[model samples]
Target: MTTFHDLRSRRRDLLDDLGELEDAFAEVTAALDEPSNDDEDARAEQRRHRAWLERQRAGLLVVLSETERALLEFGADGWDDP
Candidate 1:
């Protein structure tokens, strides 16, 4: 019941979401790098946040890979069927 348009749209949306996540990760990394905020407690909090962001980024990457594989298989199956 899925069309090529649907697959493409889904892929685009996922890619956009991935981009946003990467941007956020970069911002968090930059904030962590600032030497002025040298408070130990603050640095610990930032490290925790960075870890969470890394986990989220990793999860998204896995999902994106799976989606790409699905799209490829869908195309191949469409061509091979009937």
Candidate 2:
């Protein structure tokens, strides 16, 4: 019995997480392009962050689907079953 507002809030949180991860990735890219490959540890850290982002991305998809369903259900006029 989740409400529309609840689903919207959850979707917002997921989008916020995605934006934060994108910013973190920019930092990783900056570190990687330092004109030297002497930071294997940094590269490894970047890989880990990217993997985490991938998992988050997948999770966002599910949230998006849920939000879409909620919107549709709430907006469907005369959806009451006979």
Candidate 3:
């Protein structure tokens, strides 16, 4: 029995994680775009890191979507219980 409070809390946590990941992704993208003296290895590592962040972001988005759907199903006055 998932409560409204539980869903809201999970949604908030997921949103926070997604926001942080987006920030990191932006930073990595900026680093990659800059004309630095990084070697091939360093560039590869940056790419890998960006890819990993993208994957994590995707997963969080999926979960967030599900959570939103569940919340919607709970109706507008759902928070009255919690």
**Per-prediction TM-score:** 0.77, 0.65, 0.90
Write the residue-wise lDDT of candidate 1 on 3-53 in tens digits.
Answer: 665666777777888888888889989998777647798888888988988
Q: Which stretches of candidate 3 lie over 4 Å from their true place?
A: 77-82
Quote model 3's TM-score: 0.90
- Candidate 1 TM-score, C-alpha based: 0.77
Question: How well is each residue in 1-82 modelled by candidate 2, as lDDT tens digits?
Answer: 8886776676677667778877876776776667766777877877787778767777777877777677677786532222
TM-score result, candidate 2: 0.65
Question: Looking at candidate 3, what is the lDDT of residue 8?
Answer: 91
Give the Cα lDDT of each candidate: 0.77, 0.70, 0.91
Clashing pairs in 1: none
Model 3 lDDT vs. the true structure?
0.91
Candidate 1, residue 43: the lDDT equals 83
Worst 10 residues of 1 by lDDT: 73-82
TM-score-based ranking, best first?
3, 1, 2
Tell how far residue 30 is off in model 1, in angstroms. Answer: 0.9
Candidate 2 contains a number of clashing pairs equal to 0
> How many residue pairs in model 1 have overlapping backbones?
0
lDDT of 2: 0.70
